[model samples]
Target chain A: MTGIDQTSLSRSTSLKLFGYHPVVIIVAVLLLFMPLIANDFILYQIFSWSFMLGIVALSLMFLAGYGGMVSLAQMTIAGFAGYMVAIFGVNGIASVSIGWPWWLAVPMALFLATLLGTITGALAVRTEGIYTIMITLAIAAAFFYFTNQNYAIFNGHTGINRVATPHFLGVEWRSTVPFYYLTLGFAVLCYWVTSWISRAPFGLALQGVRDNPRRMAALGFNVNAHRIAAYVYASFMASIGGILLVWGNGQISPGSVSVDVAIDNLIIAVVGGISRPIGAFIGALIYVVLRTFALDVLVAFGLDGNRFRLLIGIGFLAIVFFSPDGVIGLWNRWRNRHASVSTVRQGGAHG
Target chain B: MRRFIERHPLWSLFIIVVIFVFLWLVFATWPPGFEAIFGKKKVFLNAVLNGITLGGLYFLVASGFTLIFGLMRNVNLAHGSLYLFGGYMGFKTVAWTGSWLFSFVVAFVAAALLGIILQYLVFRRMEGQDLRQTLVTIGISIVLADLMLWIFGGDFYQIQTPDWLVGPAQMPFVTAIKSSGEAVYMTYPIVRLAIFAASVVIGLAMWLVLNRSKIGMIIRAGVDDKDMLSSMGVPIQLVFLLVFAFGAGLAGMAGVVGGTFQSISPGEDTRFLLASLVVVIVGGMGSIPGAALGALLIGLAEQLGSVYAPTYAVVLTFLIMVVVLAIRPQGLLAR
Candidate 1:
């Protein structure tokens, strides 16, 4: 191999030699050092929430980036899963209270959520572009209102509160440090799964469908079914994140499933450059960090925290208008520039 | 008869019949005696009245949406935000002036100015691009909603009703019961009546403007083929800006009237936006009368469904939309 190939191959080999990808290495290093610098409250607020959000965004990335489906129901599905866990695992009065163990409850909730997502996907996949957006939006709206009025099941608009996190291995996993690690683990697992899926045959088929759905259908692929399948899988990921999200907050509210949250998940997916799994984590980190820190910064400058949302709105608009590929695109460009410069140096040395 | 039915494609009519039968069965088996049923029916009648009022308000809001979508082919998701902004502007105007009329005027003018500026600044950049325009407008809507929340907290707000329109009006209605009972029921909100009247007037005015005027002809031409119209020496860009501003202004008026009829809250923007979308989708995109019919159908269906089948209330409008799209992808009144 040539020297350039040797360099890239050596870099790849070194990363693999350390038993992880570059993304994993970077995330691992950051996670190891983050808590040291972060306070307990900051760690819980920023790190834990970001990780949970990362999983939801990861699901959205699969739909938007790979499957080309723009769904506004990701947050609703996640929130539904959270509600299921709370209803089934904690509070038990008259609303189908099986009182299942956390293991069983979580899985059941995720499965139900996946089924719901698949239904939504089936409906949405029938349309394209703006129509798809409207159908998913309608579904999300229906869920939001359903949860609000179904007092028998979801306790009406008040929603279920005081949901205790799972006590696993004789430790309250919701404690700041434990929760941080739990979120980290979930995020990592989700990321790894997404990476595997992205490289798999199904992932390739989804990409093919997204690129040219008509052609894919002409080739005898079941486009709508594949799209629905992606939604099901993505919903499972989001539902897990939703369950973890409730655990982190120790409560589940209708506000969690509101259009704002749904739109926020969309923003995270877009901001992270909805192209890959690593992009979700990167996007989530930026969003959570900026959102958390922007409040303090705005407050310090004598602005209301509510006004911080204006800044976020501006930031989101700028990102969509300018860098539709988001932060990941910026990073890739930077990396490419460095590689090109190094190659030029290597050529000069050869001369 | 069978051949006539086949020629007419009576699927929609059949669906309507099934819905009516379902409603009849639900009412018959309702856990109340005849006397109780009468009382409940009165309540339901009140809800129907409320639904009609709400539907009129919806028509006002959705009319502008239909117009803009027809002319520009942009969904204008920010139409809802513009509505909310209009309410806020009117609220501020009310705070400024003691007169409700002045407040209404200020609200309309302020929303119109905002719409014009937005068209020039944001949408102008996104002209001819639907998806990009949608995203930008969505961002704008989110920002505007949050800004309003910041400006006016999440608390509900209502403009002060004029003395004449503040109270309920009672009209005597003679009715014979199914059983051996006779009764008269009469009750209606004057404000709701006023809203309906105003909406009809506005709708009539909009129809006239679209049909009889030279500007209306330009708008119609613009909607048909914007590129051709622009090539034909029409200032199509100016026409779009004007149409968009006019539509937004109409949405603003709808907001004030609807907000007054209902209650204006932080969430009203999104809710009304969804309702407007349902109206547009069901009515047939780009048709004023279609929006009106869609609004009335959705409003009545929503009201009845919420009372009878609460679980399906939200899905009822969408069900109609889905059926319409499946059977006639162009919608009920496709232009």
Candidate 2:
């Protein structure tokens, strides 16, 4: 809310590159041509995973930031979509897979994930604020245990392996370069949709509800409905990310949907700055980078490699302890402190 | 009780009938038809017992969670870490000294000391900020869990049962009838029953202290109005510290109990934390009796569901939480 102040937003619009920020243009161009500079491993493993995680965390950010509902079940809902895709689409496990084409399977998965998120949101809206965290956490744990133990539909711990990715328009979408572009495309689309819709009437109303539900209800808005709808929208976003996630791994497993993942997504959202959409991507990039490289980082620092989690925990603690709004908040503060002398003529894009 | 019955007559009658049926099933030996429908009486009894015993452990953990939440409005998401830490400490103590009884004291003291430090050092600085406090707890839990893992490794650890309480004890409940008409009595693990009894005693003691003691009055008053209590010359911070420590100590002892019933491992922290969350939510946050009822219902749901429908056991627990949220969002026993 503070980030959307009239001074900053109007000032941002005062300077733009033909209605788009030059920085945004530059970043887009770089990402579009990233495959030329980055290797397949970097593209597929690092960038793609970052985008997918960012999208999921973006869902969480949408709900928590605009709706004031910090639901921990977003990952579970996303995992449900991933599982739905594996079960409905072609997978190695013939017994569980329905072997539907990607066209049908993808939509089915998204719809089901949206339904799951909507149902979870409906239940979660029964409470308010922090209770949502506990309720959704319980729901997430239940979903994890259910998927982990249920062999018939979920394939238990091993999950559904060798899930066939979309091979459409004569392009292998799962390949490193192609998949990087696909994920980048989704990421850009999600970011645009989020920023665009955020100024829409629905987003305003949702933010109103977040600020004060009683006041919003008095203003003739259906509070729960807006919250639930936001969940549906966010769930759709997460479903896309989940599909990418599953496709990236070539499998969907119970381990991927564990409570740890749910918590990690929350960490990402919070660390990135739950107040903004870009924060989710930033947070996810940082988390994924640290998680991927923490072992070497720890070893380089004369510490045990297995203490990667310890480093993450300490980093998370420091982030939470110092800047509750996360890394974006820290950046905003630093920028405000140093650049306060001049009316910093800048575009709206934090990048 | 009379007021409740008169206010909700139909609900009261339904509850009475349910209780009567449950008691009948527990007390009376099943006939051939009953046995056919409900599976073997032995299996039913075992599941029921396991559920009740598990409920006892859950109550121990959740009571503190509710107490902490009820008063301080702190979610303390790291309560499960305290439990695991206590369990590890108990395991170590029992191994070093071979004294099962002394481990509880060590576990309680260790966990309570950690709780005091957290409340004083971290939580005190961020007073009245519920979300931040919860987030900090999450960070703390993550750190604690990782540290514990680094120390204890991934292997499962169960505190050694004392020799005096290591064997099964005979109970007079008839599971079946022999051809010669000799009634078969059930023999259950004595350790589980002993632990259950201990939890029951702890619960009663807590109830008595809260309801009947001077400190309890101060604590209750603080829960209602910290400013008012402080104005009234009560050391509100001290009360908060005591309550937090007590709650944490309860969770710690529960860790030992859980370690006895089921092995404690790296993942146990999350598992127990989830269980406590479910119990607290279903039972109504900040209510002790609510925690007990929620714990019992959830424990029973988990055990019976596992016995009858193994695949959907976790689903059953989830369903109970969902239903509770839907029907009584505050919880079944919330004040």
Candidate 3:
């Protein structure tokens, strides 16, 4: 934190007065008052979901973008946190839930999720880069199967339903606007933290390990330690996202932690662009919009409404195929083509 | 084998003890005390048999997976979709032609063709980039799964055993002694035994082809150094395509086998995919015998765990994986 980059700092400060300031201000104002312009359904179902999913994907973006580790267990970590919350906190299933308050349950969930993520990370870090994906994926699948099969704690396939959400300061946090802002607060916090971490010394070391592990090791950095630390950090961030997700849905199930959902998390991170923190939110927003409205759009096109998965898959394939960097890559390509230096400053800030 | 025993004497001794215990459990009658603790003989034998048969199916799927995805270093996440596709194709072939044998052929050809397309289109284009290839496979798997779901609907389809392969085949293992002092023998589904035998033959054949044949030498050289093999005048791409097609064909046949033993459905793709992943991870990627060993261990763990614990079967399999990963990250038999 003390050793700030002289070049980036100078450039950002120069841009503060002119370039990206107006756009940032406009986006901030629009997001702050989105509830007034959008309906309850859009606020609750669309935006909140995007914020929650964005937060989860941000965890992935941090590891993949900065640390050079692609973990499929991000959603699993989120689901584990959600499951812990439902198990520890108040729920309709008295046999499963111990009826603890949110304060007690939430921290317990975060700690346990981080612990699980750390263990998975330690094991995953035993191998090289590509194996991380396979190992994490296998772990995710194992968790899903275990949750689906075990009823004593996980409540089997039906899962823990009718879970209670937090309420305080004369505000029902689960209500439309309140919940939207709650998720927005979390999304912003996670994004800021992720962005901050990318510039931190540890993050720089991680990028070094990613780019050249042999050189990093020669430079006296513990490569495995860095990768595992990245997982620990990402998992803690993902735990927050998971708790918010459970609160948003008001339930936790094995279906929520299924393999497809895990893959969808990867898709969100990739489609948004893993290079920057904001890309997670952008990817999540696009995914949420597509999931919410693609049904009607499909029907309009005389296709099966259920074919949204195909659409998402094809779109994801296209992104991976043409724009491997996602939306950010496409934007950079466009800006470079047009030679628009001022507009490109925003992308440069993250790039 | 002798060198392995020489290097790890304790492990060799432990393996010998395990083999002896397994042989006794299979060939000898269990003591009353042992039966009391471990349940009845019939149930134990049935579970063991089921585990072995399941291992055969796993080996069928995983060997192909290990070959193309593991050995070839081609990331093919859509492998499970290929499995389901083969199963559906086999089911349709059986439903239309009523020849159970023909279904296997149809499924193999169908999956192999799909494999060829994937290899040519995807792997050929991006040979060395693991992450990009993985992402592409993920996308392909998602699209394929959705497409198959659209076509097959959500119903489970199990292949019917032919008349010749139907019914239980009695084994010599004693289950119990009747009041009349006549010993009862154990019996198992004949189709499963046949499938297990077939898988063993296929496994041995693959091992022979990989180890003893000229083509195997060429393939092994390619694995070590692709550039060298190409310079040596081998048709390396053709070899890769054939291997991929062959592996896919094997997975397709395994699907038919799976359909007979257990029903195949929509989510079965993910299940089998995970199973293969665990198997390869445990067995060591790209090693044939490792896949077989890993498959058998996972299958036995799963069946026995399901029988005994019922709730934590997955945990048992995952525990094995974690243990293997902790002890030998490259797998137990990785070269």
Query: What would the per-residue lDDT of candidate 1 be over residues A76-162, giving only the tens digit for each residue?
Result: 899989988887786534463557788888888888888888877876776776766666776677678777777777887777777
Best by DockQ: 3
Better of 1 and 3 by DockQ: 3
Clashes of 3: 0
Q: List the residue pairs that clash in candidate 3.
A: none
User: Which prediction has more favorable TM-score, 1 or 3?
Assistant: 3
TM-score of each: 0.88, 0.97, 0.96
Fnat value of model 2: 0.83
lDDT of 1 at A110: 85
Off by over 4 Å in 1: A1-24, A32-39, A92-97, A334-351, B1-6, B12-39, B169-185, B211-213, B309-312, B315-330
Specify the CAPRI tier of model 2: medium
Cα lDDT of model 1 by residue, B1-335, tens digit: 47646777676589679789746643443335654644565556666777777789889889899899899878788888888888877776776776666767777777888889888988887677665677677788888888889878998888777677888787453322445555544567788888788888888898999999999899988888889999999988899889888888887777677557766888888888888887887788899989988888888888877777786777676687777766766668775
Q: Please give the lDDT score at residue B225 for candidate 1.
A: 87
**Candidate 2 wrong stretches, greater than 4 Å:** A1-7, A10-15, A341-351
- Sorting all predicted structures by DockQ, with the top scorer first, yields 3, 2, 1
lDDT against the true structure, per candidate, is: 0.78, 0.89, 0.89
Model 3 DockQ, alpha carbons vs. true complex:
0.68
Clashes of 1: 0
